[model samples]
Target: MVVLFLATSFFCVGQAAKDRFKDWAQTPPMGWNSWDCYGPTVQEHEVKANADYMASHLKDYGWDYVVVDIRWFVENTKRHGYNQIDPRYVLDAYGRYMPATNRFPSASDGSGFKALADYVHQKGLKFGIHIMRGIPTEAVKRKLPIKGTDGITADQVYTTENQCKWLKDNYTIVADKPGAQEYYDSIFELYAEWGVDFVKIDDLSAPIYHEDEINLIRKAIDKCGRPIVLSTSPGATPVTAGPHVSEHANMWRMVNDVWDHWRHLDHLIGVSQDWFSYIKPGTWPDCDMIPLGRLSIRGERGDDRMTSLTKDEQYTLMTFFTIFRSPLMFGGDLPSNDDFTLSLLTNKEVLKMHAESSQVRSLYYDEDKTAITSKNENEDWTYLALFNLSDSAPSDVWVNLSDMGMEGPVKISNMWTNEVLGTVKGKFTQNLAPHASGLYKIEKD
Candidate 1:
């Protein structure tokens, strides 16, 4: 896919709904998702515990959301992967997937996620849910009535074309079919009732670019009467469809599931570089989650343990994500975070750069090294990110101050450590450990 570097309008015709809620995510959203630790079987208590952790610790530094990831409606979820074999799904009379009360016990009364959402909201944080993009196949089989429709139903509006292959839960909603928009509208309407603050819709981006359904969902959200942040996932989100997704979704994945490994982190450097131009205030190109702290307790990929990434590499993970201004969704179990991991999330200076910096762009990229730069329009300092892509040996990464729109003597301080690394002129260089990175602020002295 060809990456286009263009600054275009995020809105198109028939986007009256988008115009109102477009400002909901003015900066990259920082939150915690349950998928990294609990897979699909995250219990209501687990969700509340994470929320409690976020509220007590991370909320002051902008980490607010506590999201329940995929398969909340599955009554029997398995670990190490999905419960593809005899997975029991729960659906409401209206055919909307409801939280499996066996898993989310608060929904035993059929309140769905309302009680959990209220629990999260009471913590001064937000709540989000993961959903597959389409109508539940069971809903179609049951021929459930599409809410707010004149006897229209789920089976009438869905199509088998381009249906999600890996997960057999839902059928793709036909863009122009009758009740299609209502199907989406009804779901978001339910989410609004549950007081959902964010929704990450999967199978709607990448390999199959579901722009029409995205529009339907966008319209659904606009009509829901809530400022729900929309996120599209499992990307490499067809680089050419940037503007369309930008208009409809607040955070669309730029790469597939990024694991806690060196290569995965290495791969995102390029994806972020390719998506650099699209980093506007409201629309962010997500680079997946931060698989740090304690991960894979009962996750889809691995056995229970902390992340496999080493300390230096973890810094690169935080450094690049912050400077690139991608949404920081911590994928680990928050309550289990160690002192070192907690330190990564609490640094005010690094997060300030993530939230405030503008004009973010790659200064250069190559096999051995990569450099990225940004500026806060409100401040005089220029922020820079330098990474050593090399795996084994220490390497020197270099960039010219002139390229960063700076010249002459300038004081450079490490944003992570806040240690002044002295002054430099037009040419500057920093030696980084293998797989390590650095964040610095350059200001004219």
Candidate 2:
């Protein structure tokens, strides 16, 4: 895969749908997704409970979208397939997926999700669903009747090569095909009528092919006459396609399923440094989610143990994620949360840096093992985030104001605690808490 970092100035053609993305995901969406936390086993009741919790607690901080992840089909719901039950329950004869009857009995009239979404909306929240990026395998095998705008079939709109790996079935939509737009338009139309505000299309980057189908999906959302925020998943959304995808997608994942582990965070941090340039307002580079607190489900294959990170390490991770402007999606179950976790998620000061700052860059670092310093652009005071990822070292990192295109003594204030520390010379240094961070505001004094 060729990864290219285009300068932010390069203009990509095609306007985003209905200007829906105008402010759709300006500060990176913060919400709950079922896949990472609950896997394919999430029932409608469990989802409603989670949504209820999010509405009551996390809404004040802007965590609104409640997404129902994969395996919602009826054919995939059968007990024999392990994870692949009846795909029919997830999707239906009309090519529309609804909540399973066993899980959501009200869905027999194609109104299960309709009721759920209504409830979510009544609570001042949004509803979303996930879908693999291809025609159903069963649909293709049975040559199911298609619902094309021009009376064409879905089979005519897609090809077999776009199938997802690790899954037994699904054909990728041929975005360039004659009826592709009409086919995509059909799905979004169903969703729009059902009141969906977000849709995550998966298997999108398998072998990372097809910019045409991507464009078609974007177009479908627009024609639906609804503002559906589109998110592409399991991104290794190649950097070569970054510029184009940034414009079309409100937010996209930057890695495979992120679990609650140290190595995952370590790897994600390194990969994101190269993505800083793509951190514009509407488009965000997602680092999966905060897998801390209480996550007890599949894909979260850890000791249902409490987060192993020390306070310092947790702060360091949160600081890096917030300053880098990654979407602050929490993966832990919201209904049962500790005060410590809530405090971290609801910190207004930390979130302010993520929402407001436009420019972020690495300012200084000694040997890679010792320390690293990052800078954020704040109109009033320049913000600095210093972290030490090393296991055994107390990182001593410094920043020189003059070198950063600034002058004079720098007055510093802690961004987290809001304590104004005294002034420093052109060069100022801080001893980092091991596996921790020091987020500071520097002003010209």
Q: Give each model a TM-score.
A: 0.96, 0.87
**Where does candidate 1 clash, by residue pair?**
none
Model 1 Cα lDDT, one tens digit per residue, 104-174 = 88887789999999999999999999999999989998899998889998889988989898898999988
- How much is the lDDT of residue 299 in candidate 2? 37
Global lDDT scores for all candidate models = 0.90, 0.71
Candidate 1: which stretches are off by over 4 Å? 1-17
lDDT (tens digit, per residue) of candidate 2 on 291-386:
777775543255344567677767877887887888776777777678888788887777777777766766644433222333444466576777
Q: Assess candidate 1 and give its TM-score to the true structure.
A: 0.96
Candidate 1 local Cα displacement, residue 260, angstroms: 0.7
How far is 193's C-alpha from truth in model 1 (Å)?
0.8
